[model samples]
Target: MKRYLFLLVVGLLFFNFGNSQAYYFPERNSNWATKVEASNSFNQIALEEAVRFAKDNEYSGSRDLRIAILKGFEREPFHKILGPTKKRGGPAGMILKNGYLVTSWGDTKRVDMTFSVTKSFLSTMAGLAEDQGLIKDIDDRVGDYIWDGTFDGEHNSKITWEHLLQQNSAWSGELWGGKDWADRPPREGGVHDWKFERPKEPGTVMEYNDVRVNVLAYSLTHVWRKPMPIVLKEHIMDKIGASTTWRWHGYNHAWTEIDGIKMKSVTGGGHSGAGLFISAEDMARFGMLFLNDGKWKEDQLISKEWIQKAIKPSKPNVNYGYMWWLNKKGNRHWEGLSENIYYAAGFGGNFIVIDQENDLVVVTRWLEPNKIAEFMGLVNDAID
Candidate 1:
């Protein structure tokens, strides 16, 4: 009886430990546990079909073409973290160049929180605003755009619009991370008391910062005389003929799951990231817009010159553009793009790669952390 009780106790302890080891975030849902059993969920199958369609049209694979595709997906640390959740509620729909349905990969369900990818969307809208003379050039100062005293700090007031776009605003990024200013709500605090760490002179360096983009978001509203979401819907989404079923989760950053499990928005960008939920097909259309110089079916959504200037390499650094990443060698032999393929990437494997020179736009959405290198190798080999 003693031995039997001991074994029973051990089993119970093991079960308890196992339960303790269960990995879960505060916002994980049962839907995430529900995997997509169909092979049609992944965009790869669709991409293969798209490739075959292009091949039928006498378009042979070139090293340059593949390189552009691979470079777009590869070189990002965030893309690797999207594979495991592939079966979970992720990206819906797929669109490709070369004119084909690609493969079936679920419906055009507007259920995806494309993180920083929204930044690219916002950036494009800002560019359009500039073209329409609503705002001035990228070189305009923040004060010039949002005169409501948002940028009225000693150092921050001097920050320019280009500085925010370039990620070189020199403002302390920690301020927005809910660090010392947790009690202070963002964008509502006193501008005079805002403390910023000026590492280097603005416009001379590049540092990825979300607060700067939030500032950009605020600036867009100030200039457009409309809410940011309304601005986007009116200017970009409607202009691009995107589905109106989408909703921007402005606050609370909760995921709209089938069940009651409210998932908090991870990655980055509230509206910049968690706000804009879109279908992969619409994302592909967005990519194609950039691919075709911001023109959709001969209707110019944005000016051709604006598109050219946005993707073109920035001065002093060829690795980044306006709200986009460029394929440029950093230090090692990492040759990403032969001609700097511009890509708009989002967290959780959301990618809309536009290789203009190669006439390619590849879109992918998955959930696997730490599988980026493996997928990147596949991408490189396939592209090569």
Candidate 2:
């Protein structure tokens, strides 16, 4: 009887100790402290190799980013992109272990355009809308909320918030000078092939179209009844204690009237220039929130169910989520990376990789696409 009682006490103690060692927020203003006090079959050498890889393999994409974006979209040259972009950029990133900054490189502090990584943040805003009941049901017809002719046609009328989130809505027409078909035309097709292609049933096929993502942005603006940046700042960024240096932007022509006031409808990506411009450290903090299943410290910034929903593969594209890229079966999938590993990816190889299995988060900028798997594999090998 005494032994049984002692065993019960021991089990309780172990449970409490295990719970105490869970995740925590990193210090806001300080450089991350290295916990690699000892070296060996541990991550010290792996960290060194990873740093070297980032420094050597800079993005091999187009040197002139603005031109690349414009040509990709087949759009006219505009005076300026909607968001701020630096004339220069270099390899930058941060490694987080159990919600603490483990290491970082380059100008992680410099605010640079994160491009399509903005989509993940936009996805977060949509998750927020769902959490606050601003959007009743993602599966329901968004036409109920947005009465504009945007989703009015027979094929389009069937679109739901889910379809838009998945980029399968094939939402017709134009927004802010960008056309649905022209945003990112397939390399295999001519202009006529793209323009004349009939819209597929929602959720039947997936296409990566920035204009449709922008439609989600515009619709979300209506649902929240505020500029997306304002909503993002108030609810997500500030709540997580993000630095004041970050900026979110929308196109100059995207502004229009809503409820007797004008608001700018933001883009889902920086293809035309304007999305989330932020420091790597802040990006890590944001990734940590998702790593902790959408919790910030003690406040539940977003629900676990929503995180599950966001990370789960969309029917049309197993590699894509609400906006996050899954390291599963898509072209970007890495054979060595865990299936559960997912990321917020942008142009020029910018990535915020979440490895929940390892309790690690890695944010990188200007990382070449071809070398991603190689880099990720090296990091995995570091795990002792």
Candidate 3:
């Protein structure tokens, strides 16, 4: 009886201990430790803790977050693949934009919603349209096309493409839904009832609005006379050859907001938060393409001059550009970031940070939500 009791106690202890340890999300051969140099600053313990937290919540680290680490090591090598055979974590594959350090993180095959990172991709598309004379200028008024009654008035009609890019349009419509994504109308009289009337003036203030961007997408489609997705494929994705796949959620049916309000049903246009989907490494590849003056493997995907213009701070906001946000602090807009470090940030801490001086692109995704800035701070400290 004592022996049986002893075994029972031991088993209980083991169970408790096992419960105490955070669950770890497993990836095949994810022993990146063998690849990282001793001199590198990444805290392996911290990363492990993060992974465990992700797993404990069934957060889908790769499914939701497309994070990977790479370096030029002699002993260990990297792998590449596209989407998953099963419910995989990340993308199908990635491309080597530039050598050992230039390689992208592929193989894990995680694919999830990449939210606002879509805007950065869209900015490149706009740049291409500009370069090809498909669009006149960023400063052009949105009222010229899409005779939507929204921008038809005198004050509202002055809203420019640049205003939309910078989030300076000041068009006060519905912003974000907080609770149930399915209950509210997407827009008023759109496909549903959640339609936007009008806000204040153009380029007068800065308020983050996703529906405004949808309008930009519509404008692009109207001018190009082709689906925005096709334009993105031909101009940006294919040009870079990044070996990744993505889809736009569509203007009317992509998402159900946390507030139960669906934006697609309202405006018949997809908003910023629900439109984009891509892999973390692919995102890094895209960021690097920008970092290298919009060149990819000896091909100039975007004009260097245009890339510079895109990154530069805007007149009104000082921290946002055409679908791109600038990292400015000391100068203005409270960006509170170093000049060299810029990021493509998305909902739930999805980020692709580009360090121009360091020649590095750090991609991270956290299913945990709201902890991205903290993790990014840690990554920043490690790399610096």
Candidate 4:
């Protein structure tokens, strides 16, 4: 009888521990829990001060953020910088610990172009395609499905989905009226000399070129057999319970036809214009979903294996993953944050930082770029 009672007690302890480990997802109504209820490990005052500090730093962005990027980067013609854009909010963010809102700042409802953070969403779509067998092998030459001249030519044909995902595809091309050299020209060279520089082998050099990223976007469109936004709405955004206010816009001139149907090819960044315009709440949901290893209430939205590979930094750039930014080597960027942390960062100071170990998801928009580290450090210090 004593042995049996001891085993029964052990079983009860394990059951309670498992129950404590489960997450408490927040609903859409106003009943979301407070910081105290959401987290027992973090100091509430520290969290509040962190948010207050972030809110106080809201005005650090260029007074006019709409064309601030243009003022910073003079590569593209001002007229060509077109598509969809929005004036940013002050500082905005949603903090989640164990899937509950710990704190939030600014206007979570404001929808603005998230810039290159769109690359992470684009990568998610590619992941969804791979998960559903739409993409047989990431190593397969992209030229196989995309018969268009986009992936043709000797060097270009050697490029694969992995190469593009890693930003090393060196697939030479001008798409959406943006040339490779013109996208991100050298900082210290004459335009004439930069444009004439010889191209390198595919998968050799890692260049953050939107033209190449757009080509990858266009290639995925053919494989999925539909517009990417539609695919995302059906498969990801809708599943995560995102709001209807979000949008993913492509350039008006970037239309491509497949199977007698024509659609606009999306971009991986809001460079010239148009990218992901989503609410902070929605982006928080995205980070939370990823924090749970691509699962949403037992539904494996994406494979765990793919996510593992997605977060794993590429060979050339340990600081970058499929489309995510990793803090590899512990000092790649975030000083006080853990090396295990990764994020989706964008221009105009947008971020979706995920720290699975702490069960934290932080979404910030329109904050000062330089102050992000300090803000994140403050948040981390709050945790017990």
Q: Best candidate per TM-score, number?
A: 4
- Residues 28-95 of candidate 1 have per-residue lDDT tens digits of 11121111211232356444644343223321212232232234334332222211111224333343
Please report, in order, the local distance difference test score of every candidate based on alpha carbons.
0.52, 0.81, 0.52, 0.82
Worst 10 residues of 1 by lDDT: 23-32
lDDT of 4 by residue, 279-346 (tens): 88889888878998898777789888888989998877888889899978733578867988999988
| lDDT value for model 2 | 0.81
The TM-score obtained by model 2 is 0.90
lDDT of 3: 0.52
lDDT, candidate 2, 43-160, per-residue tens? 6778789889988999876657776565545543232355545543789888776665566789888887788999999988899998899888779899999997888989889999
RMSD of each: 20.8, 3.7, 17.6, 3.1
Q: Relative to the unseen true structure, what is the C-alpha lDDT of residue 118 in candidate 1, on a scale of 0 to 100?
A: 76
The residue-level lDDT of candidate 3 at 286 comes to 74
* Off by more than 4 A, model 2: 1-21, 36-41, 62-64, 71-84
Worst 10 residues of 3 by lDDT: 69-78
Off by over 4 Å in 1: 1-95, 104-110, 172-199, 252-268, 271-273, 315-317, 331-337, 367-384
Tens-place lDDT digits, model 3, residues 184-263: 22333542223233455677766555556655665666666666667777777766654546665563332333234333
